[model samples]
Target chain A: MERTPPHPEVSAFDLQLVLEALVDPVRRSIVTQLAVTGEDRACGTFDLPVSKSTATHHFKVLREAGLIRQYYVGTSRMNALRRTDMDQAFPGLLDALTTPRAVAR
Target chain B: MERTPPHPEVSAFDLQLVLEALVDPVRRSIVTQLAVTGEDRACGTFDLPVSKSTATHHFKVLREAGLIRQYYVGTSRMNALRRTDMDQAFPGLLDALTTPRAVAR
Candidate 1:
């Protein structure tokens, strides 16, 4: 049996961990992709700049931080952004994260 | 001459750098204090758990990330949250940062 990795409860999400996970550009990109699509995506489909192991690490960080939810669909891992949960836990966080970056002068 | 340290232009603010600076608890606390008080504060007035050198480093990071502006007042260094600048550059970023920390769970 393929065990689902444990995820932190949304109510218990730590701001530090979420910020730490989001501090990585690759991880932020992953999140941006999900937010842009508004759909669950497969682990292998997103455009990641890092190697396989590195992508795995980023997904793990996102999952543990409760920023994303992952589940297995056959052999492919699907990831969905935990938008509502995160917003409930930390208001405006996803809005901040998903907004267009560095636009003003 | 007590020259003011360089601050990144709001037009050039980088989300990656901002997230990196904000990931630390001490740095976030400094930001929180300014946001909560809505006034400039002397460097020595903040309740930081770190050493003087460490606190100085945190302030430097926050200022460089364009999250705060620092100026000298008499013999003391005063820090002010760059709320307007940040709001213009990265909407919702400060709102998320200033909101209560980890209160959901």
Candidate 2:
């Protein structure tokens, strides 16, 4: 039986990759948008005011950093947050990073 | 009656810089070592298994990323985690990233 390249194993390097990937504000916004949508979304769907080239660069950065998994679902490439891989690598890490804290009354 | 550089100013970009800086495993290990020491240590202090050039490269990456502040303290250079600037930029985001979790029984 042929074994598929089991999802790239997670390590401290992978953790770093994910952290660095989400560090950009634009990327963070993309992730927030993805999370709110609750499913994969096309790169162009985000209303980022940057130029098309910049947007593409940002998406490429996000993809290379391992923050999001992108696959061709027909002509459009779908992008979704890699929450499962991230959670497995560092449990509760993604939640803590993305969760919004309430302001003091 | 003049002000120093006024701390380069923190923003989302700065957050990205910090995140990218700490993403490397070698750099992360250095940060952990610094945190445990609680006092700035010389670059030569850490017994990194990498070559001198590689160690220097790692230190440069850390410095450029804004995760740690390096300054010349006499004949030796001192390094400390930029916890204050980072905390201001994203609140408890750093703690969430660095805290280790215990495995469940």
Candidate 3:
């Protein structure tokens, strides 16, 4: 039985939590990929270096932090970057982190 | 005999290290104060909730990450945000994090 996951509200966005979620390179990669592609990606479609369970954990953290929104499209869990929520809560934050200078190194 | 501490080169500025340095609320507060005042301040001037040793540790982390530069003026340790270096390295990162939204939380 699959169910939709919970997400923090835009008003409840926490910069600390967002930073924690983005501190890990893998999670940041997930975000950077989404920002670059500007598309929702399926859980398995991301080129992550971790195991399935680990990737799931990363997605959970991003979702909980309001950085990403997750929904079930058929059997695949699709992840979308919550760019609007992020910008409203912390202006220019996503743009800063997703830019080449941020993701390059 | 006090000596100037080492800082990572601008070219060697690492996002992971910068994120780690900014993740802590206390350290982020130091950064916010700097960004708000736009002035080089003595170590004791910042209003931190941590003890002296903890505050010192925070300064060290910010300094080593190239987020801030610390120098001795007489006997006081003065701290200055390396805005130019950070701007060159990460572009809008500092401005984003030091903005009201990032610091508001």
Cand. 2 TM to true fold: 0.59
The per-candidate TM-score of the B chain, in the order shown, comes to 0.92, 0.73, 0.95
The residue pairs that clash in candidate 3, if any, are none
The full ranking of all candidates by TM-score, starting with the best, is 3, 1, 2
Instruction: Write one digit per residue (lDDT tens) for candidate 2, span A14-78.
Output: 55556666767777788777766678998778989788889878877777665677776566667
Pick by TM-score: 2 or 3, better one: 3
Q: In CAPRI terms, where does candidate 3 land? A: medium
- Per residue, candidate 3 scores C-alpha lDDT tens digits across B3-97 of 88887899999999999999988998999999999999999999989899999999999999999998999889999999999999888888889
True contacts kept of 1: 0.80
Candidate with the larger lDDT of 1 and 3: 3
| Residue range A18-97, candidate 3, lDDT tens digits | 99999999999999999999999999999999999999999999999999999998889999999998988988888889
Interface CA RMSD of each prediction in angstroms: 2.6, 6.2, 1.1
Candidate 1: tens digits of C-alpha lDDT, residues A10-66:
767888888888888889889889998999999999998889998998999999999
Which prediction has the highest TM-score against the true structure?
3
Supply the DockQ value of model 2. Answer: 0.22
TM-score of chain A of each: 0.92, 0.76, 0.96
In model 3, state the lDDT of residue B104: 79
- List DockQ for all candidates: 0.66, 0.22, 0.77
Q: Using DockQ as the measure, what is the rank order of every candidate, best first? A: 3, 1, 2
Give lDDT tens digits, candidate 1, residues B1-105: 448789889778887778888888889888888988899999999999989999988999999899999999898999999999988878888888787664222
